[model samples]
Target: MSRLDTQIETQRLLLRVQRAEDFEYFAELQQDEEACRFIGGTAPRAAAWRKFLQMPGAWAVQGFGMFAVIEKSSGQWVGNIGPWHPEGWPGTEVGWALRRAAWGKGYAFEAAVASIDWAFDTLGWTEVIHSIDLDNVGSQELAKRLGSRNRGRGQLPAPFEDVVIDIWAQSREEWRARKR
Candidate 1:
């Protein structure tokens, strides 16, 4: 099996490779107005279908990508969160997008910590960034908790290039220091 098919578990959540069964839950997240507002706006199921497959494709092409975030206790797909860096991305970003119901539960923080550790220790990434919209206060806070800080402006691949975002990041040395 591909490395993406492997599973990474936390105390309360399971991070696994994205799968077809996750489409419905992912579509629901894409349809959530509040959750999608910063990530790109609510998308129709057809659009969500195309977007949903991107992570798996990323894994095949990049060897690493977002993981399907599942609630351990409930066995429900909560969202996707992990290292992502597509063509023309500002940097390798550890991003997250959870369903509305999963908000304020600390899941993002928990999963991010684990993902960042993997990116640094396993993937040997020197650093990680979070391309967050200026208005995404929640993600900003999460980035802060991850020991990242707003570095400067950032750009995304075409179609999203016009969207403004703040680059929040930290070096592996910084993250290692924080862990000590």
Candidate 2:
């Protein structure tokens, strides 16, 4: 997925791919326990920036994408929400992770709802996927808030428990109907 450093303006947040300037803030969240707990572990600063540098041009290269989530008001980064696939999963998996401080204000729901709109309306993807760590009840609840249904078990990458992962999904038709 190629989610470059392009900026997508939402009502309250600026959803962009990622940039080097965001490294420090990005590193902080990656190192945050509550933030990275469900997302696995923190990376070394150099490694984090190396990975950060890789995001700006993926959508053009890859058929599909990932993006860095940013708050428009403060220009501060809260977390990442994007589409990442695990092997040959049917569709692009849309996922998100936000800092603990950014929680409870409905930022996740607000920005993600717009991202979902872009996925179907802009990229023209017929189906979008959602998955989260089983123990991350807050995210599971957020999926419910976004109206995705659980599709059940699957294996994720390292540090992720090989437990029952809850898969949540939405089709283009479903999303379009929801809009009307």
Candidate 3:
């Protein structure tokens, strides 16, 4: 199996591959109007199920995908955050989407740091980007905290092509320097 299948542990989070049992949490996350507001709109169970499979399918086909963010204290799936690059993607991205309950807890920043490290160190990526919606102030702030800067507006592939987004990015060298 690919090394990307492994897990990452932080003080308060567990970043790992998606599991069958995590689907329930994933579905619930998708259905959360507030949580899904920026990432995508809430979906019905059937649609959520299909969208949920995208991560695992990406792992199987691309050897890397977003990691399921688990809250260590509760052992609950809190969100998905990590490397993601699909067909016609804007760029190699380190993205995130957390449950509304997980917000304002610094969990996203912590998990994103680990994911970005893995992307550059293990995946040999030279840079990482976060494709954030125009109005996602929280994420834009997180990107700034992570030392990423908004490069400019970007376009998503079809179905989301009209959505306004900005590409926040930092190079591996910049990340390494910041960590030091």
Candidate 4:
């Protein structure tokens, strides 16, 4: 099936491959200082456009990438969450980033659960990781809630090499056990 044909639904959200129509929402999140702080700092419109395209590109090349999350009730683009592993990435990861307005609603956690399940069951991954910033307490908590513990410090590639991050992860067996 085409990548676009792939979609997963939760009680309140729809997770699917990124599409052109989602770019505006993607760019908006990229420009939100608080929302983008942990993921990457805010970007200008031009730069946001480039950054936004990376999801689809990754899906095309890698068969998996962050899914554009949509709120089922309002049918609004809420954020991005799912499998992501780029060149020189620390490991296969299940990451998340939501618009500021979507915060405090448990959307990230819900979407992340589905994403991690997909990464393991569908993608046949043995393990999953979440590379989180040191000061991003919110994400750290979310990672913990998802049954991941900080494995230790890890390095990012090139431009991000200087940035310190913690690798939070769990094996597929661990995840399956938790879900039981």
Clashes of each: 0, 5, 0, 0
Candidate 4 per-residue lDDT, tens place, 40-81, comes to: 699998999999899888998889999999999988899999
- As a whole number from 0 to 100, the lDDT of residue 10 in candidate 3 is 96
> Which candidate number would show the highest TM-score if scored against the true structure?
4
Q: How good is model 2 by TM-score?
A: 0.85
Cα TM-score per model: 0.97, 0.85, 0.97, 0.98
Worst 10 residues of 2 by lDDT: 55-64
Candidate 3: pairs in clash? none
lDDT of 2 by residue, 40-65 (tens): 66777777777566555455566335
Tell me how many residue pairs clash in candidate 3: 0
Candidate 3 Cα misplacement greater than 4 A, ranges:
none
Model 3 Cα lDDT, one tens digit per residue, 12-53: 999998888898999999999989988879999999899999
lDDT for position 78 in model 1? 96
Q: In candidate 3, what residue range of length 10 has the lowest lDDT sum?
A: 1-10
Alpha-carbon local distance difference test for all models:
0.92, 0.73, 0.93, 0.93
Between which residue pairs do clashes occur in model 1? none
